[model samples]
Target: MPEKVKTDLGFADLQCRKSDVGRISRIAKAAYSFNRRFFGKEIKKPFHIIICYSRKEFDDIWGAETDAWLTGFATKTGTIVSFRDDLIRKYNPRKEATLAGTLRHEINHIFYFQIYGSYEPAWLLEGLTLQPPFEPFTLMENDKKRLKGPLPHLIYSTNGKTFFKQAPFLYSMAFLATRH
Candidate 1:
């Protein structure tokens, strides 16, 4: 198949493996609608969403600072980089409950960046992304263990590289902080 199939999803211009077009499109649409209503702002310009079919592809795009465990992430310029849900499901059962919200979480980061600008604290950015109206926010056993450690590592992270380097631990705490 072609490396990627391109399509316009109204709010986003997507590029993905031919097989991911349908599934990614659905998630992107839901993410767009959720962000629009939750943030009370619409992405006026069409942003980009790139879905990688495998870990090598994702790592190639991510390059330096690539975290082995991240399912998806957003850039400051309004882009979402991710694996399709099937790929995520096979490798990371821990993230299963939040699989459908991966795009939404990335979209949430985009909205957060758009509204707050860059340099906002990573905890706030991550915490808010895991907040309600997007996904049901479930925690697995691994998540529970992270809560036992000192939080400075999770709370002090100020960039994606640092936050995602410890994403497995940080994301769970981030969600817990925002669950109210």
Candidate 2:
């Protein structure tokens, strides 16, 4: 088992396995830089970043059987990022980019939650968070395709099962509408 290490970024704090310190730091730096450049400042409130080293660890901590498909998520208070050690050991040039992207996505959620004081549509939330081409106000081919489907009118009160079931399509549509 790997030992845990924690680093404070002032605006955010990171806790991850010792072996993953360098990668987590790089991701944090990139996320902070991106937020500063675009948002004009660091996040207004401090948040926690918990990084798990394996699927089991992530599930255990989050209490969700995310099945490794979810690399991370954010809440009003913080973000959770995961990197399966076995997966990282494999050669992949895009790994860092993916991690940084996830961090950026989560950070945007936290920022928006604080600023708006209420949750926005999933598409708007994710679109704003996703990287360029899918950035806040930009539309992509997928977003256009998603617009043709049934769209959710309200963002609240949907049951958990229904919300999870419709998440992918609904978020895509929301992103398209936001762009428009």
lDDT of each: 0.72, 0.63
Error of 2 at 105 (Å): 0.6
Off by over 4 Å in 2: 84-97, 131-159
lDDT, residue 134, model 1: 65
Q: Which one wins on lDDT?
A: 1
lDDT of 2 at 39: 65
Question: Which parts of model 1 are misplaced by more than 4 Å?
Answer: 93-99, 149-156
lDDT for 146 (candidate 2)? 65
TM-score of 2: 0.74
lDDT by residue for model 1 (1-180), tens: 477778998878999777778877787788788888898887665689987777887777777645556677777777788777677765556555444678778888888777777636666777887667666667877677666666535465545466555667666767876665
TM-score of each: 0.83, 0.74
For residue 32, model 1's alpha carbon misses the true position, in angstroms, by 0.4
Candidate 2 local lDDT, 1-180, one digit each (tens): 878878887778889777777877887777767766766655577888887667777677666676334566676555655453345333222234356666776777777777776455555676566546323334446656666676556344334476667654555555545556
